[model samples]
Target: MKKIFGLLLVVLAVFAIASCVSEPAPKKDSPLDATVAYPPKILEHKGTAWGANPPAWLMEALKGYKFVERMADYQGKIVVIVEQDGESREGAELAASRLDAIPRISTLMGLRVKDTFAGAQVGDKDKIETYMERVVKVASETRFSGFMMEDSWWTYLQTYTPEGKADKRTYRVIQLWTMSKAALEKQLDSILKGEAANEPKTPEKERAIQAVQNAFYEGF
Candidate 1:
């Protein structure tokens, strides 16, 4: 009977120990968890230069306009340059109003004014050209109607030197543009079929035609 009581006491002690012991707390997902997937690719492009070939007449019209640095299209919409400064802003507003008044252009696609900083220092001429090309390519690929330029300055520790002084530099100016994918596809179709009857046959004409085609297909 004593042995039985001892065994019962031992079992109760084991039960008590098990009850007192706690299971490990559930692990929480970290705020910077890598398990989360990246967002889906968006149809948009951005750059420092224009991508689409504007009509010859439009090009001539834009001449002598220093504020109008670059222009391009997002789908059917005309993306115009908008200098964020007071003078440029006023001009952009006037242009926008006038564009809204135009039946032919406005009816087809509305205008989009993209703000830019004039005094930005972007490397040498070659680098600037390359940057513009990249922007235009991105704009075409992404099918974005408008983009804005943002200047960013930052200071970082110069660890290369023994003193490790704080160094400041203009990190970069980022341009981001986005447009509706559906709108871009629709405009591309219209552009491809608009003048099919009088399609250019000359090499220059063919190249021009190819440029628009590539904007839709190759996105550059």
Candidate 2:
């Protein structure tokens, strides 16, 4: 009886395997006739392949999302330059790219400048520049340009959006600026001089700043 039961189980397994193998696959669609829906249109343009998951045109303005520095012609003189995109305001995806790019450049500048500010003696404490973070932030907020010749220097950012699929909103800006090493030194000089000239007259200034800081911390 046990031998007969084992043979029956083997036969049932074979039947199940045969049934699976015999089941047909779904048929694929084939064109009924050689009919074209629309005219053949060019899928390539201006050195870029146009239709292969085409990127937003604003992205084309940047070579990549990394912080980039290069020497380029500035009023006929090659100069040290670092470029960052203004925070974009288009779709969240493109804006995220700009947001990512902005930090890399800002952090590079912030860390380098902060390093320069380090190791000053107690006498040089009067020359500390505190508004650099805020100043770098302002470059993202609005459109402006100047050639202050080393103070403001020849660096100027043009806030404009790349055409094609991007909205016409002014907030979608391309901020490209060139700064030479000489410009950085000149900027530092100006900051040192300005702070020295306007050193706070009273101790209350420090107390007031600390109070504001404490208030924010306590609130948090």
Candidate 3:
């Protein structure tokens, strides 16, 4: 009887294996008349003007979602100059003076004057130069030609109140400026698509700005 039971178990196992082997796989979709839809192409444009505060032409050119810069140029094509917010003003000022003294500084660093984001107490001269070189290399690969300090240098100075809270204000002005500009640029982008009235026209010099804007925004 034990021998018969063992034989029966062996027979069931064979049947199970055979059943699994006989099962069919799912069919794959063939190339017959089936249509596949793809995502739409996004428009690319420079973000020089603040998005929310975008010049009329800029907003129009960028009909789709567009990336723009705040601390740098609006479209990442222009460079911006910045200084610390009041905490690291000293370092920023020092760097600016250094740059002015050495016009070739940008070339040495592989950066355009517009691309350098110098800050205070961020690093020593050698370190700053090295950092700028790397920054320029990377920016060149992207949409930017160069960048400059957009930080309000005056703000950095004002933070040092008469009460001697200078130490508390220890921050890299240029780095902070870069970050702040990026944030503001994003904020402005949100408002780019919405309708807003044109910026007020002003003096002759201001009128010249319109022509530049026309070129930038119109591109024709």
Query: What does candidate 1's lDDT look like per residue over 136-199, in tens digits?
Result: 3333333333322212111111111122222221111111123344565555455344443244
| Candidate models: Cα lDDT each | 0.29, 0.31, 0.29
Q: What lDDT is obtained when candidate 1 is compared to the true structure?
A: 0.29
> Least lDDT summed over 10 consecutive residues: which range in candidate 1?
152-161
The numbered model that scores best in TM-score is: 2
**Residue 85: error of model 2 in Å?**
9.1
Candidate 2 structure quality by residue, lDDT tens digits, 1-220: 3322322232233223321212123234447733322211111212122222212321322332122322122433212122222233344224433454345444545444444334322232332244333333332331222222221101111212222122222222223333454545455444434443454545654543333323321211
Candidate 3, residue 145: Cα displacement in angstroms equals 9.1
Which lDDT tens digits does candidate 3 get at residues 1-220?
A: 3322322332233223321212123244559934422211111111212222223322222231122232124453322322222234465556554443134223322343112233222222342343334434533333322234332212111112232232233322222122233543343222221111222334542443333323322210
Worst 10 residues of 3 by lDDT: 39-48
Give me the displacement of residue 87 in model 3, in angstroms: 7.6
TM-score each candidate.
Answer: 0.22, 0.26, 0.19
Per-structure clash totals for the candidates? 9, 1, 26
lDDT for model 2 comes to 0.31
